[model samples]
Target: MQKAVGIIAEYNPFHKGHEYQIQQAKEQTGANIAIILMSGDFVQRGTPAIFAKHQRTAMALLGGADIVFELPSFYACGSAEYFSSGAVSVFNALNSIDFLCFGSESGEIDTCRFLGKLLADEPKLYKEKLRSFLKQGLSFPAARKSALAEYLKEKDIPFSEDFLDTPNNILGIEYCKSLAAQNSSIAPVTIKRIGSSYHETSLSSEYPSASAIRRELIAAWNTQKFLSDTLKNAQPPAVKDYLCALLENETFLIEDDFSLLLKYELMKNTPESLCAFSDMSPDLARRIYHHLNTFETFTQFAEQLKTKELTYTRICRALLHVLLNIPSDLPAISPAYVRLLGFKKESSSFLRILQKNSDIPIITKAADYKKLLPKEVHSLFEKDLFASNLYETVKCNKKSTAFTNDLQKPPIIL
Candidate 1:
């Protein structure tokens, strides 16, 4: 038996369900160690996490994972495909990771494999039919599922949404798809999600959604008012202090640190130039640019400009692509390196394994990265710069004007 298991996650705020997943992954695999690939300050849904990376990493460590690694912003904040690919790459680097574990709507690996195969084997005509359906008014996801199901039906492949529309399942499919594509030896597995489908707002005593918890925290509502019976074993970190730091003046990150660049990109740049980043279609940009002045914030702006088929998250990702100039080709080639944000003592062994087996360089510290890598690594540092700058710009009380202060400054936590 291998010494470790791989868990790809974003502990935006740890809760009962996640705890269950970690324990189950361990139980199912009979592996002693869990290597978690986590998103940094930003997550795939393109939002600042309620808690910072260190805190989340700390929570995972406190809960049970033997090691934690950062999933760089380049991959962390992108679409499902990129997120899965990045996690898969990191886990693949760790020859110790015998299993890649995740939570899904349906835990059936065979069904996931079937859908994963069809998506991988997408025929030329299938794409054409999908595009035509998009023209007739189907959303990209809807068109994709429709086209995929038609292909599956023709091939007599059995599959179901079992969870596609919900957020986690969508990413789960991508995970399976990525694993299949990479031909990784690690096995794919899923733990069916427990309660309140992804984004469900009401907080239940037994199975509250992470979104609900976030909403309560954002509203400054007391956790005692919403803590569930099942969550007794969960024990997330203190929320008040964390949120205070987030809402406080000059704490960690600021509001501008996030979408400000995107806002400016939308207002100042042309649709042609903006099309280069992740999922930035020209038509979407045309709509976004016109609505720029009409709304104030990204959320408001997306609300004002979004078509029925395009979700707020989808449009925001496009806008982010415009801001970062994240070309699709760039992710395909350049994001070969995985940046280490923060980790605990056990990570030393995991790092040794990664270094020994990884085909790509594993960057452990920012200062070292700057000294060793070329200017392109700046893309990675630049986003951090943007985060600091945006945070400063939004939180006026912060005295320091430097956005790059923490860059090459914050070393991995031992």
Candidate 2:
């Protein structure tokens, strides 16, 4: 049987570290193929990707992926738990994957799996403890961590809070839990994240965080400097060239890059209408409604509403959904189809196998999307189309890419 390993990612812009993971995953698993289910225009962080999805998809192929699929917007913009489970569900539905590989700060498969099992088990005491923490006003993630720690202490199982703290480690644990919940046959594997931490902001390291790279790239683009010294040194040769070329014709966007439009959406809609989207608590909605005229940018608005309890990222994501008019109930549903972004021409055999074993519809040609999926699924996909159009409107002044005409843009064949 042919073996393939799956990776879930938001190659917001592919970097050296991502390339390393792909090479390591393929070599470690000895898998014949690597399939990456990547986020589309929107990402889990609740922000638009710096470059468009097709551009990033090209980067993924250049970085060493055989196949790349879009992780529908519903999951792409969700929290870690929902995002991981949604992607895992898609991979599981394929029934052709042999292993799932991801990068983590800890890099220990056993430790990650143990935490995953505990979370999935969700013993009685853990639930009580979690509810207690939630009642105390902690964020959902914090409450879950505290509850798990207390549960472990009661069981006399020593565990470090660090396991649940770091960004990559938290995501790794979620991947394991999702696999367990689905009773998936695919094995989970981990690679130690190298160079910089996820939140690192400096581009001095060989492998800076994606955040850092984006920061430098944005600075360069803003100043009419296509590739700054920092970005040139930080990225791999091909990646640096690709990004520099992209910036020459397009813009470098941040998480709240489209905040002006978001503000318009918030100001144009009733508070009640805004409440229908995810992460919009009544209190948060009221705050947003009252502050609509106070701040000029979405980032400023988010910062104004940000508190110890309400994080900046959370605020940004919530406002983004409002701008997109995304329904709050999206997370309740599974992704409707596997949207193919791009793939290597040489991977025909692998693609054939995936199509044969896949349970969901595999979308290749964008023009045939309606014909391939049900009306309801197509409606859900329209969210993706809407997101693409919004992102492109920002680039209207810049040169056009494949993303400009996503409705008819075929998947890139490299």
The C-alpha TM-scores of every prediction are 0.85, 0.96
Q: Please list the Cα RMSD from the true structure of every candidate, rounded to 1 decimal place.
A: 3.9, 1.7
Candidate 1, 243-283: lDDT as tens digits: 34443432333223455656766667777766766777777
For this target, which candidate reaches the highest TM-score against the unseen true structure?
A: 2
- Spell out the clash pairs found in candidate 2: none
Per-residue lDDT over 270-320 for candidate 2, one digit per residue giving the tens place of the 0 to 100 score: 778878998788778888888777977767778899876677778877887
The stretch of ten residues in a row with the least summed lDDT in candidate 1 is 247-256
List, in order, the clash count of every candidate structure.
3, 0
What's the distance in Å from true for residue 13, model 2? 1.4
